[model samples]
Structures are given as C-alpha cells and as structure tokens.
Target: MQQPHDTPTLGKRAALSIAALGVVFGDIGTSPLYAIRECFHGEYGIAVTESNVLGVLSLVFWALLLVVTIKYLVFIMRADNDGEGGVLALTALAKPKQVRMGTPSWVLVAFGLFAACLLYGDGMITPAISVLSAVEGLGHIEPVFAPYVIHVTLGILVGLFLLQRHGTAKVGTLFGPIILVWFCVLAALGLPQIIGNPKVLSALLPWHGIEFLVENRAHGFVVLGAVFLVVTGAEAIYADMGHFGSSPIRLTWFAVAFPALTLNYFGQGAHLMANPQDAFHPFYAIVPHWALIPLVILATMATIIASQAVITGAFSLTSQAINLGYLPRLRVTHTSSTHIGQIYVAPVNWLLMICTVGLVLGFRSSSKLAAAYGVAVTATMLITSILFFVVARKRWNWSLPAAGALTVLFLMVDSSFFVSNMTKIFHGAWFPLLIGGVFFIVMITWEEGREILGAKIQGLTESLSAFMDQVLADKPQRVEGQAFFLTGSYDRVPMAMVQNMRHNKIVHSEVYFLHIRIEEIPRVPNMEKIELERFGSGIYRIIAHFGFMEEPKIATILELCKGLGIEADLETASFFLGREKLILGDKPGMGRLRAHLFLFLSHNAMDAAGFFDIPSEQVIEVGAQLEL
Candidate 1:
C-alpha cells in the first residue's frame, strides 16, 4: 500500500534542519578546506594577487548565488516526484508510459541515466576528496605530520567503510551537531578576516567577477573549474529531498549553510589578499596557531560526515535503479527499523570503498582530486536543467518560452563550468568520466537486455483465456491447496503454470496469476494498491502495485489482498516462480558480448523469492532456457 510521504512536524523542523547540515551540505561545506588553495596551487592554478583574489572571490560568490541559490534552491527543488527528488525521480516524472526507441522521450531517459551514472562518479570522489582534504589539515599542524598524511587518510577511509554494515543510526545523531559546529566555526573563523579587509565585501558585486574573467580570459575560465568546487554538493539539496523534506533543506541552506559558506570563502579571499604566500594553505592559515590542531580534528570529523552522506546517497540511487530495472537487484538491508530509506547494499558499499581508497592512494592529495571533481557534477547540473525544462513545460503547465528562458540561463552557467572542467580531462579529470561511462553502459545494457529478454519470454506465454478454456474442457483434476503463479503480464498465462499443468496433470482448486507492477512514483496509495479480478471458475488475476521506494513483501501483499475480499491463506499456499537461463546465439537481439554480460548480471541478481520476502520452502522455480 502506498503511504503518504512524511513531513516533519513544526517542532521537528529545527531538528530536521540541523540534520540537513550533515547530509545535504557536507560536501559543499568542506569546500572551504581547499577551494581557495586549489585556485592558486592546483594544476590549473594562477598566481595569487589582489585583483585575482577579488576576482576568484567574486566568482565563487556569484557561482553559489546563481547555480546553487537560485537554480537549485529557488527553482529546481520544486520539481519533485511525489516529494522525492533526484535525477532518476526527475527521469520518472519526464518519461512517458510508452516510450519507443529513438524518440525524444527515449533520449530524455538516456540523459537521466547518464546523469545518474555521473552521480556514482561523484559518489566515489566525494568521500576520497572530503576525507583526504580533511585529514590533510594535519599537515598544517606540524611539518612532522606531512609524511603520515596518506597513511592517516587511508586508515580513516578504511575505518569509515568498515562501519557501513552496522548502520549509521547510532552515530548519525552526531552528524548534525558536528556539521553544525563546523559551519559555525567556518563563519567565526572567516568573520574576523572579512572585517579586517572590508574591501573584500566588494566581491559581492558581479563586476569584479566580470572584470576577472575579462582580464584573465582563458586562464580565468579555467579557474572557474576550481571555483565550481564550492557548489559541488548543490545537487545533494535536490537528491536528498526524500530523506529530509524540501522545506528543511531550504531553511538550512538559507539560514545556516549559505551565510556560513559565504563568510568562509570571502574570508579566505581576504586573507589571501593580505598574505599571498599563505595561498599554499590559506584555509588553515586563517586560523590562529593554537587552534590549528583542534580545527584539523573538527575538519576531519566534518569530512567523514560528508563522506557518509554521499555513500548513503549512492545506496539510495542504486536502490531506485534496481527497482526501475535499470540495474540488477542486490541484497538491500534496512539499517534502521524506523526508516525505509536508510539501507546498506553490500556490493555498492565495497565497490565504492575500493574506488575511494584507490583515489586517495593515487591522487595522494585533495588538490589533485579537485582536478577531476567538478566535471561530473557540472554535467549532472546541466542535465538537471534540461530535464527541469521538460518537467516545467509538460508537468507544471509552464509555457515553452518561459521554461526555455529559465533553462537557457541555467544552461549558460552550467555549460561554462562544464567547459572549464573539460580542460582538466588530461590532468586527472578522465577518472570520473571513465567511471561514469562504465556505469552508463552497464545501466543501459541492463535496461535493454531486460527488454530483449522480456520480449522473448513474452512470446512463449499462451493466451490466458484460451489456456483456461483448454483446462476447463479437459476437466483437469483439482488439487486441495491454492497455488499462485507469478507472471510478468496480467493477460498472459505464467510459464510456471503452463509447465506445472503439463507435468503434474492437475490444477489447484484456487489458482491465481500474480503480477507485481513497480510504479515510477515513490509511493502508491492503498486504495489503488491492489487490483483483484475474479476471472471465474476458481481462476483469478491479482496485480499488486508498488512504488519504487518500496519492496514487495508477499505477506503484506497477501494480507492486503485478504482485506480487499480476495481470500488467501499463506500457510497452505504454493508460490510458483520462473527462472530464465540465457544462451548466447546468433538470434536477432543484442550482440553476443552484451548477451553474455546480461547473463553474468542475471546470475548475480538477487533471487526473486528472497527479494520479495517469499517463503523459500513454499516456492518452486520452473526453469527455461532462452536464446538471446
């Protein structure tokens, strides 16, 4: 049954906002650690000067305002899918029920898929960069600590991933407080610097940024790729809407996050203007010498919180993909009894751990990873703008010109950042692109392979009405117990039922053809959850509707069916499921390489009985081999 999306009560709003600090703003929150430093020391870095500092500060200010504040906060967050927001949710909102290949709708789906793929790329880098950058603060404490930086980073990352299985319910409470203090400290540290160099406030003006770009031109454009780092987690505001409602996120950003980040960035610029050599490590330099170690410890905690948020997001995205059939199902264990969205996928967790650790050891420094960081996010932002336009026009009833104007403005900003980041492709930017490309291929292959396989399996089914008539004519012996045969489509006779009739020569007294339909929305209402059709002669068709955010529990489904006047006794019921074996051949389908890839994926996919929480002892699998 579809349940209404939960909304925090007025009293809980403050709490939710605090929690938002840890999850939604962590990545962007940690940017102050290295953003300004990168602009002067990264591979594409320029000299630190008065005008350059002002220009970079202005660029950072405006990028946050335009890209994050206006684009994501004020506008795009509204394009939610039943209170769930993300690239995939947006994809679901934009996709039509019947999308043919090579159509605009199909292209939109592809765009969403690629955006999601980029998120996995973003997911891998976020933890590596956030944690590494945080731990790198130790080097600022003492020159003696410099050599141990990589070892400390690897240890911290390993420990973090190891804690994933136990779930974050216990430690999660600390996230809000830690991140809150982190942001508060950011403002406290930067406020004094901004006051010292009051002229830095002029960066609030767009002309300074324009002048920087106008003067520096190509180099300034490249610097934008670094500046883009400040708003890297902007998508989190939208992606995590399902976890914390939009109101809390918006409130937290405007009230706590936005002001704190602005002060920190401007403070870094102001400090840089005063002491140019400190550009080597401006964020740590801004702090008093006595507080340096404490700050580093705090920064490490904040970064770890940030990494946890991204890892959780990866879990959510993968769960959504699996439900949508764009990826194979994996074992999903709910981490919290109170929250369905809080889950841990073993495969996703370990895969992310390997990649994140590899990145830390390879890049060796946060500044290096910064080179590859912004591309995937900018690409995702660009794609989001495009999808938002589609939703604005079709779903929101906005006029084409109106949606086009708003989208074009976002596109211009996103495209500029995307192009700037493009220059970093040779300087370690290829990593995310390669990761995104591999994930995109896998997602598309799974989706297309399912279609091909479903088509072939579909052809093997007999007409339900004809098959029933034949059974009636033959007067087959009736068994005592009820039998439920799961089928892909409601009108088709299940292959399991067909095979059972041929082998056993008896039909159960009460038989049901069960169809589970996974809907695009996050939740389906209970009234519309189940459709029970009595086809007569003890044969019935049962369709259970589930939202993407939900997992189908046969016990719950059967109970709901009973409530709807469709009798079901689970203890005596027999469940029949189909097991398809793929054989690569010269058939008119996918290529042999892809066919084998699909087979490998299918082999690893979680069994349907376990996925649906069916009783393994009561379930029977009817196997069939199909040439693809």
Candidate 2:
C-alpha cells in the first residue's frame, strides 16, 4: 500500500481554496444580492439616514464577524467528525454510541436531527429567494423584462433541478471561476462608493449597531429579522467542510469571501447614505448602467451556484440521517465515483423543486421569500451553538465554566437573532418552521417505532448458538448453493432464515449470516470493514461495518470477503431478505398515530435487496409480521 500523504503544498491549498469558493461559499457569497435590500426596505425597515445606514451596515458587519467568523469558522468548524463537518457529524460527535432515550446525548441527537431537518426548509427557500432576487434585476433593466421576471425565474429553476440527474461534478468546476468573478464584481461595485462616502466605514464599530437598535427601539429589533439575512448562509460553511478541508475554507473566507462581502455591503451603505430613496434596490442601484446587464447575468448564475450548494447539502444530510437510522432508507445515487460526497437523491430533489417553485409562485417576490428565510437558519444556528456547548464539555473535556462562558456568549447572539426572527412567525417565516416540525416528528416517530419493532424481534428470535445446535440435531437436508441471510441483530438468526427452515426444511451447503452495522465515522477503512467468523457445518457469520456517509452494499462485502480468503460462488448464490409486515400498536404502549405514521414510512421505504445492490434474480424475501 502507498504511504499516507503529508500536508498539501501551497499551490494545492490555493487551488482548493479557489474550488472552495464555489461549493462552500456559494450560498453566503450571493447574500449581497438581497441582504442589504431587505434590511432597509423590508416590512419593518427604517428610514435610510446616514447613521441608520451606518448602523445597519454595522449590524451586518458584526454579524458576519461574530457569528460566521468567530462562532463558526474559528470554533464550530473544528467540531468535525473525522474530517467531516455539518450537523450530522456534530450530532455523532456529541452523542455517544448506545445512549438511551431521555439522556442528554439522546436529547441532543434529536435536536440535531431537527436542526438537520430545518436546513431542508432553508434549502427549499434559498433557491427561490436567491434566483428570484437575481432575476428581479430584469425588472430594474426595462419594463418589458419586469413582466417576464417570474416566468424566467421558473424556467431557470426547472432547468436547475433537472440538471441534478446528470450530477454536479462537471457543473461544479465552472462554479469556482464564475463565483470568483461574481465576488470580484461585488468588491468592484462597492469600492468606489466606499471611496466617495468613507464615513460608512464607521459602521465597522459595535456602537453604531447598538445606537441603531436604541434609536429605532422596538422597530430596530424587528428589522433585525431582516438583518439576519446577511449571515443566513453561514451554516453552509460548516456543513461543507468535508468536501473542502477546514484550512482552505477558512483561508478562502478571510481572503476572498469576507473582503468582497464587506466591501459590497459597505458600498451599499455608502450608496444608501447618498441616495436614501434607492433603499428598495440598493444592491442594483450601485451597478453602472454598462455593467448592469452583465452584473444581472452573473448574479443569476451566482445564485444558481448558491442554490446548487444547498440542494446538494440537503442530499448529503438526508443520506447521513438515513444511514444513522434517524430516517428511513431512500434511493441514493452516487453521482461521482471518485467522491462519495457527490450524491443525488431523487425524492429530495423533486420535493425541493416543487416546494421552491411553489414558494416563488406563492410569494411572488424575493422580499416575501426573504421573510421566510431567516427563521429556519437562525433556529438552526442556535441549535448548533447549543450542540457545540455539549461537545466542548463532553468531547473536549472543557471545564463547565469555560464551556458555559463561551456558550453564553454564543447563545446571547443566537437568542437575539432567534427572538428577532420570531416576530415574523406569521409573515411567511412559519413555512420553514412547519416543514422542520413535520420532519422532526417523522424522524422521532421512526426512531421510536424501530426500537419497538426491535424489542418485538428480540423476543421472537432464539440465541444463535441454540438455533445452530437445533439445526445440527435436526440434520435438515442441506441445499446445494451458497446462501446469505441479512439481519439487524448480530447474534440472533434472521427472521428470513427462520421462515426458510420452517417451510423449506433445508439449509444451504454454505450459510452466511450477514449483519451490516453503520459506525459513527464518515468512512470505515477497508482493513477493518468486514469481519468474518467461521462456524462448523458450513455455517458462518459475516459482519460488515460502514460509516454514516457510506452505503452498505453486498457486492462490496463479498469482495472484502474474497480479500479475506473466503471465496464464495460468483453466481447462483441466494440472498434471503426479510419483508416486514408491521402490525401497528399490536403490542401496545406506542401511540396509534405515531405507529401508523411509522408503518406508512416503512411501507414507502426502498426495498432491501435493491438498496444493497443484490441481484434481483437471486433474491428471496421471506415475509414476517413485526409488532410495534
């Protein structure tokens, strides 16, 4: 085997940082399109006085530094699970293996799952708002283009979602260069304005934000719901850490994203200070007439890249949730063979597409969708801060005071934002919360339902050694071919095997009991992936270990077995799988509603044989009644 590589060279780091700008910064990169506009013209927006302009700019500035820079890039991004970041990884890191319900770890995991679910809502709203805001530029260009804004936005969205099937690996390469140009334009647009009204730079201080809040009093706090938009995509930075290592991401942010975003927002501030009436379209107003068309085009493409990042994030989180058993299995298509991170989930993609398009039609404007955007992300960030506290205490072994002090600081910021967004609960913000709530229910119900089903199964199945002894004593007719039985319980005989012995009264010449276990890490090494145990009389046990980011496949398991010097038949091997017929509330204790929901979810889940990539012709599914 080739030796492990050392730290990457500076040239490679620079390349990775540039690539990171595409996928990692895409969502946050496009914030300038609408973030500043919302703060001044949103429902609770204040008059665009110079001090107010400086104040709003100050708020946006500090939000990026404290929330995105200090809390996330400097801190939470360090909580990666074996080089993987995101709530899923944080959940695994914070929650130990085999933590029981009602424990702190268990509660944290549930919260983490809810946070993950909230991102889906964020995902749906992002594309609609991002693309609509960019496309809204057409309305600024000419009266005729204004009429077709919605139509053009819809067409682009449809095309974007349809492109998912072909995968984003190739599209991703173009994202870096395009986004790099977009950021440069943001900086360029802002520079001259800042030069003209350099006083807007005073907003860099914390006092202006405080004064703005004090002067506007209650209204200022409410407009914070809008100001939160500047940092709305902050979570994406941590979520994509696995794709680009943290160093390159941090480097890209401080070097490229931070400078560009700062200049643009300040530029917008400077422009607003001069032309207060342009508050409604500050981002566009700064554009030179000659650059307007090209800027709009770049913004639209940039927003598409933003939408692509979140959509892919939704896919990655969904896959991890399924593998970790928080959600039911779905059809996961690996879009790139070289990178496991590049995935396409059909159901997630279509669902997002429908919701996003519906949001555009229903909202009719980016300003309306903007109201729905900040709530989910603020709540998610709040949860992330809470989870980080637990991780620092439990994993890093930090003293309570140390953890509490840092956590209190984060919570103060998070709570302020969360409370501010709460005011808009009815003004379109309820949509994503409702979405998050429904998924949280689905996740918890499925987890509890599976536990109940496992308990029932445990009672029905006998010990493996005892079953083997009985089978040996019976001397049942040994079949001709190799047979594989997949089970969740490592030591208990599979229900399918039990059914086969009861009816067919025969065992295969070579019997393998296979149990696939998903570990908490992102990827399992091949050396420790598959473990085989030999039992006399042609019976064996095979255990396959996978990480939450990986799919457990039978072909891969068999290949590993071959590596271990256990060569089985290449063809004509039978694989036995259990087809569970769940009897809702048959054993009592579980609520009827949740039980029914779990049954519905289980029924809709993908088939085991197909999920594991077993040959259809060689698959045999034995039916069993499972009580929940």
Candidate 3:
C-alpha cells in the first residue's frame, strides 16, 4: 500500500484543489457577512463615523495583508512540520534533540498542546457564531423568521454536524463553484455602491486606521475585539496548506478571494456611509427583492462549508495529538481512504455537537455568540507568532536582528488583538476561555500523570547488561539464535528478556537494543529514518524515528530497515511491550478520586498488540507497577 504522504496524482490534485476552494475558504469567505459590517455597526457602544468605517476597513485589510499574507503565507508557511502546520506541528519542529525531563523544550511542547486544546474551544464557537449570524439574515427579510431563527439555526447546525460521519467528498464537490459564485455575487452586490461613492475605497489607506485609533482611542481598542473577527480563520491557511500546497492557496487568495472580499467590504462601507439608516441589512438590502431568498440560501451554503472546515480541522488535530502521545488513543474512522485528511472521531464529533448547540441555545443570536469567538483565535495566533519566531532563528537561521524585528512586529499586532479581545470577557467572550481552561487542565493533568508513571517505571526497571550477567551466572538451560526485545523506555531492559535470561542462562549471540523515537513532525524523511550505534559483540542499539503525521507501524519500519541491512522477520524477532498496572496510593497533588479514575482508565486502555500493529504471536507483555 502507498504511504499517506505520497504526492497526489494529477487527478487527485485537481479534485482536492476544488475542495480547497470550498471547504478551506469557508471560514474566511464568510467573514464578509459580519466582519466588515460589524466593525462600524456592532452591538457594542462604539460610534459609527465615516472615518471609523474607513479605519476599521483599513485595519481589516492590513491585518489580512500583514498577519495572513506576510507572516503566514510569506514567512510561517515555510515553518511547516514536514508538510503539516499548526501548534502540534510547531511543537515537533521545536522539540529538543536531547530532552531533559523538565527542560524548557518540554515545557514549550506542553504550551503548544495547551494552545491546541484551546483551539477546540475556538472550533466550537466559530461554527456556532458564523452560521447563526448568516442565518439571522433571514430575519431581515421577514420578521416572522426571527422568532424561530435560533431553532432553525440549531437544527441546521445539528444536521451539519451529523453529516460529518458521511465525509465531505460528495457534498464538497459543490463548495468551490458555490464559494466562487458567492464571492462574485458578494462583489457584484456591492459594486454599484462602491462605484457610486468612490471615497469608500479610501479605507484602503493606512492613515485612516491610524486616525481612527488616535481619535477613538478608548473605543478603538474595543473595536480591535470586533476587528479580530476578520482574521478568525487566518491560521487555517497555514494548517490547511498541506491539503492544497502553498502555491494554490496563495494563488486563490490574491487571484480570486482577496479582491472579491475587499470589493464587498468596501461596498458595504460605502453603503453605510451613503445611507447609514438604510445599512440595517446592507448586505441583503443591496440585492434586489426578487433575489433576496436565493441570496440567503447561498449564504447559508457558504456558512455550512465554513463549519465543515472547522469540524474536519478538529478531527485532524485530535489525530495528530494521539499519534504524538499527548492524548490517549481514541477511535479514529477513516471517512475517505482516497483522502487521508478525511477522518471522523465519534467522541469528538458528539462533544462538539453538544457544545455548539449549547452555545447557540445560550447565546440565541450570532451577535451574542460573536463576543466569545475572537479571543481563542487571537490567543492561538499569538502562540503561532511566538513559535514562528523560534522557527525563523533556528530553522531558517535568520540573524538575531532580523528575527527579533519580525518577532516584535508580529507580537505587537497579535498582542494588540489579544488585549482588545480581553475587553469582551464579561460580554460572553468568557465562554471560550472557560472551555479552554477546562481543556488545558485536562491536558496538563494527563501529561503530568504520564510523567509520574514513567518515572515510577524507570525506578523499577533493570538494566539489560545486569540482567544478562545475572542470567549467565545462574547457568540454567541454554537457547540458540538471536533475540530482539522491544522496550518502552531506553533506560530499562524488558522484564520478559530478564526472565528468559534468568531461566535459560543463555544470552543470544546477537541481542539488539532498539529504541523508537516518534517525533512530532508529520512526515519523517527517509534520510532520518534510523540511527545505529554499536554496543559491542553483535549488540546494536538502534533508534528509529517516525513523525506525528506518519503511522508508527513496526512492519513499515521493518520495510524501512531494508536500506540499513537489517532484516526484521516478525516471526523470528520477539517483540516485548511493557504493561503498567497502577497501584493506587495517597497521591498528594491529584485527589484520591482522580488518581483512581486515572488508574482505571489506564488499566483498560487498548493493548499494544493492536495499537502498534504488531503480530500477536510475536508479542510479549510484561506487567510493571506504577504508584499513583
């Protein structure tokens, strides 16, 4: 079977490109619905002036230009973790070669994972806020729809969430053309207003944003909270770069999406400036009465596609986390084998559905939900900016001066947005923070729990050389041929091997001490596959590294070892796996209840035989003790 990272054929590439236009562009594409309009006309107590509109638009335009275009498209995309992007990918890139237990590198990886857990909060809120806001446009056309809007939005959201299990292939075929037409229609709707009042184009000037910031200094800081919405999906550009190469996304943005979005936003600003009172539903009002219903339907479709992108993103992130050992293994179902990225996790899907529905029900309107949206995105963006700086200095080998300057610039922009969003904490933005807080706690607890368990195992472990000496001294029965033992930790020898040595008193002529290190990178290059160190007398210490994006199957590694002159026949090579049985004690930090729960969960985890894809006949499980 072909590996997951194999380059796509021409036909697959074409299909994926179309899907990219629809699914990938959804979140950013739907920004025109509220991002531009709300900047001047938000529910918050901010004044709407011509300069403010221009300034807000200027901010939006430059944010896209600086953060999305310059930072990610130009600089950060190159920081991809072996064709993958996002916090986990960055963690893999930044992970230290020689990890001391509690070093700064390990802490940074934990920080990255925390950022990822926080994204789940953003993921839930984005769909809720984006879709509801779009559907609320129906209330503008007919007042009767306003009463049932929340229910209708909830039903539609649930339906969309339900559709995830079926995969996006069939429905996704309509995304590219629909979004393409949506952008055209969006621009076309605003063209007359923009052309009529050409001054609206002045929003493109940076001075207007500066003036607005100077004049409305207090409220302008608050506007950053609303303005941050414009770039909510900016990180998706980098995260989804592997699906469609940086070339297509860059081309799509400049060639089609950017210009159209700018025109629509400018047109909206023009409509507001020309007739402020008439700007109540300027987007729909711009369309002819006969076309209003069709426009609403199109907008709905666009929002659904955007939600689909976020939902799929959650699945991909969760999978990456599991593979990298940050998360426990969950049931992962391949939604489409033809597309390795198309996957479904039932637990995650259901959890998101519950949270999203709860949000919609509680907030009741997208405007209310909007307050909770930007903070998480901004926080994640801030984390990305920090990681990118590291990538610039270490990976790209940029000078300290150049890297420091770039880092400062990004930090100013990202921190400004983060601080601005902080103003919304009391106004419903606290929801995502609460979600993120809970997730962060869970992640940290699990990580800390694992470390404590690993340390306990290390203390109980016996060295391979000492075990071998003990076995030879006993002088029992002697066996023949070479035996290779698989161990979880590099410090300890497998207990099964110790038992075998003690009983048989015969050391295999060639005993291999193998250690596998799965890196955080999505794809490990063939050149970095395996490293060998001779420990003397046919005893070789081998380290094999796999990336987070790649499956860690021994069979595949064995195939990979063909180049290293090592023949791995599973039937002949004994695979040893350690099973940790937790002994519950009075753990000081974690309460007795949590400790018991952790022990119960750990004990019932899936066996390594199936998880590691090793043959049952060739596998040996030795019980080890862990005190919690």
The candidate scoring highest on TM-score is: 1
**How well does candidate 1 match the true structure in TM-score terms?**
0.98
What's the C-alpha lDDT at position 311 in model 3? 92
The regions of model 2 sitting more than 4 angstroms off are 1-7, 102-104, 585-589
Task: Give per-model CA RMSD.
Answer: 1.5, 1.8, 3.6
C-alpha lDDT values of all predictions: 0.89, 0.89, 0.76
Q: Candidate 3, 529: how far from true, in Å?
A: 3.6
Model 3 weakest 10-residue run by lDDT? 1-10
The local distance difference test score of model 3 is: 0.76
Model 2 residue 590 CA deviation (Å) reads: 2.8
* Cα lDDT of model 2 by residue, 1-628, tens digit: 1111123689877877888898888888888888888888987778888888988999999999999999999999889888888987998898878876667668888889899999989999999999999999998888689989999999999999999978888667788889999999999999999999889888999999999999998989988888888898889988888777888889889989999999999999999999999989899999988888888999999999999989999999888889888889899998887755788999999999999999999998998888888889989998899999989999999999999999999999999999999998888999999899998999888888778777777787877898889988999999788999999899999889889989999999999999999999888999999998988898999999999888898888998899887787546788999888977554554688887888899999999888888989998999988666
> lDDT of model 1 at residue 345?
97
Over the stretch 1-628, how does candidate 1's per-residue lDDT look in tens digits?
A: 3212255377678888888898889989999998888898888788988899989999999999999899998899888888888999998998888775567779999999999999999999999998888888888788899999999999999998899988998888889999999999999999999999999998898999999999999999999999999999999889888777878888899999999999999998899888998887889989999999899999999999999999999999998899888899899999899866679999999999999999998999999999889899999999999999989988999998899999999999999999999999987888988998988988888988888877887798888888878987998999788899999887889889888888888899899999998898988887788999887778999999988888877887898897778778877799999988877887637677777788889999999899888889899999888877
Candidate 2 lDDT (Cα, 0 to 1): 0.89
